[model samples]
Target: MMEKAYAKINLILDIVGKRPDGYHELKSLMIPIDFYDELYFEPSDQVELISNVDIHNNAILKTVQLIKDTYHIQRGVKITLNKRIPLGAGLAGGSADISATIRGLNRLWGLNLPNRALTQLANALGSDTLFCLYNQRAVIYGRGDQISILPPGKPIQNITLVCPNIPVLTKDVFGVFEKAVAHDFEIVYNTYLVTKKESLLYNDLLEPAFKVSPKLKDIYNHLVSLGLKPHLSGSGSTCFLFDLTEDQKNLLKNIDDVTIIDTQEHQ
Candidate 1:
């Protein structure tokens, strides 16, 4: 069986509060993009993970183990990952991979688990994994486990994603943000009612992301100097510009240490 794990971008991310368990409460509008990583699975006696990227602390491994232990399934599977999405770019690549694995294995093993059961299992993997299972635009809240699916809004066309070479850890970004200020939840539910073009877009982690890697601010400024309105995707490193002209796309192609991804093609 083959599954595609699509990447995602946070259109608007805001910190609501902190939970007693030390997890931060979050409210955000998240959408899946065309960019994806592919996972191939086949039945085997022993579970195995094959990938070019580093497998240490890999979410896929954890997901497989969790499934086996949770269900008491002795069957094993061989999984191969064809990695296209860049790692550590705040694009939820790892989360997507785990979600895909859960969904794929459920079918492969004939588990026939209900969506609610799958969602519950996904939540145990990571904050963003449950959202990935839906693979559509939605409002995510309560540490990203509670999801409310939205009707398809105005499509965000011609998006150009620029992923910087620098690596930014999500935990590091959140650590800096927590120390800087206390964020109060705004009436952001209204923002989701508008079209993608008309919605007020923002990321609360932007300032702290800059603190984590000052070079990201430099990249943002450079893109602005080119007469482009670029916003950080989620946490850091990857910035996206919407409705770019062909000339602008060509110009951005010349920049070093950057990858240009078009979301329209994926749509």
Candidate 2:
């Protein structure tokens, strides 16, 4: 069984409130994009896992072990992860890959789980896992598992992402949002809700994300300077410039450690 794990972007993200579980409540439009990591499940005689990236870091290996202990399943899956999405870039590459793995293994091992059951498994790994399971444009809330799929709306135009050769920890970016330093969420939310002639895109994580990683800020500002609507993907590091011109794509080729991925607005 092979699973293709996709990457997602938060077209608009707002930390609405703090949850009772010490996690912040959030509202965001999440869209899975073209970038993906491939997972191949090989059923073998022995229980084992392998990946090009570190096995300790591969979520498939770790989650499989967790499922094994919890379910006492008879079958085992040998996983091979081909990591393409950059790690720690606010892309949810890790979580998405894990979600894909869980989905793949369920079938390969003959678990015959329903979507809801798979989603329950997703929640055990991370709140964002459920979004990955759906792999469509959705409005996510309450720790990111409470997803409501939206009807097909305006298609997203072209966007280019530039990720500097550095990692931006998603947890650290969220910490900045919750700290006593204070930030404005109301203004951003107001901006997000306005339906427009074109697609409305915004990321509340931008200000604080750039604060920690100035290079990421540089990329964001650079895009804005060029009259492109720019937003940070997920938490930080990956900055997306929307509706680009041919010249912009040509210019993007000159940047270091950047990849141009075609993205769609999931509705």
Candidate 3:
């Protein structure tokens, strides 16, 4: 089976608190965008993973191993990952790949596992992995394992993501954030309850991300100068501009060191 792993953008991300285990508690509104990476799976005598990028420590390989060990299945599968999502852009590219693998293997191996079972495995792999399994807009909380799917509000259309070539590691961003001032969750929660307006979208990690990558601020400022409202997606180097006019789109097309992707939800 072939599966497409869709990238996601965070509409709003607020850090609630830190846990005793050192993981940060978070509340985020995330939507799966149209950009994707493709994975192909075929039955094999032994597990094999192929990718242009490094595979030895790839999330997809880790997921494959986890499934075999947990299920005690001797069956192996060959996986081909054609990656499109940029790494370390806070796009959840790796998480999406693992989600796709788990979903595809469930059917290819005829495991017949329930969604809850798959979600359990996904949560173990990564916090964002569970959300990727659903491939829908959701408000995620508690280290990203807890998810509440949002009712279909308005479909997000005409989103343009400007991913600077620089990659910002999630851990690094959080590390800086630990020392930085945090946002008020009460305010964030109330805002989310009231509306999904693009103007209200915010990310608490932006300040720390700017600290980690100074150039990110320049990009943010540049977008603002162009009369565009750009917000960081997750702990990101990728900033999103929503509802861009045709002229603004043309202006972005001329910019350098940035990759642009249009938003499309997975069918």
lDDT of 3 by residue, 1-267 (tens): 899998998888888768998999998888898898999999999999888777447988889889999999899999999988989998999899999999989989999999889989999999899889988888899999999987656667788889998889999999988534566655764576567566767788999999899888888888999988998999998998878888898898877888987775544
Winner on TM-score between 2 and 3 is: 3
Q: Which stretches of candidate 3 lie over 4 Å from their true place?
A: 178-195
Clashing pairs in 1: none
Task: Give the alpha carbon lDDT tens digit for every residue of 139-215 in model 2.
Answer: 88889879887654565656567766788987788778743333354454345545542245566677778778887
lDDT of each: 0.84, 0.76, 0.86
Please write out the lDDT profile of model 1 over residues 91-204, one tens digit for every residue.
899899999999889988999999989999999999999889879888899999999888776667777899998888888988888544443434554544553443367788
RMSD of 1: 2.1
Model 2 misses residue 109 by how many Å? Answer: 0.9
Give the candidate order by descending lDDT. Answer: 3, 1, 2
Worst 10 residues of 3 by lDDT: 178-187
TM-score against native, each model: 0.93, 0.87, 0.94
- Weakest lDDT window of 10 consecutive positions for candidate 1: 179-188
lDDT of 1 at 104: 88
Candidate 3 CA-lDDT value: 0.86
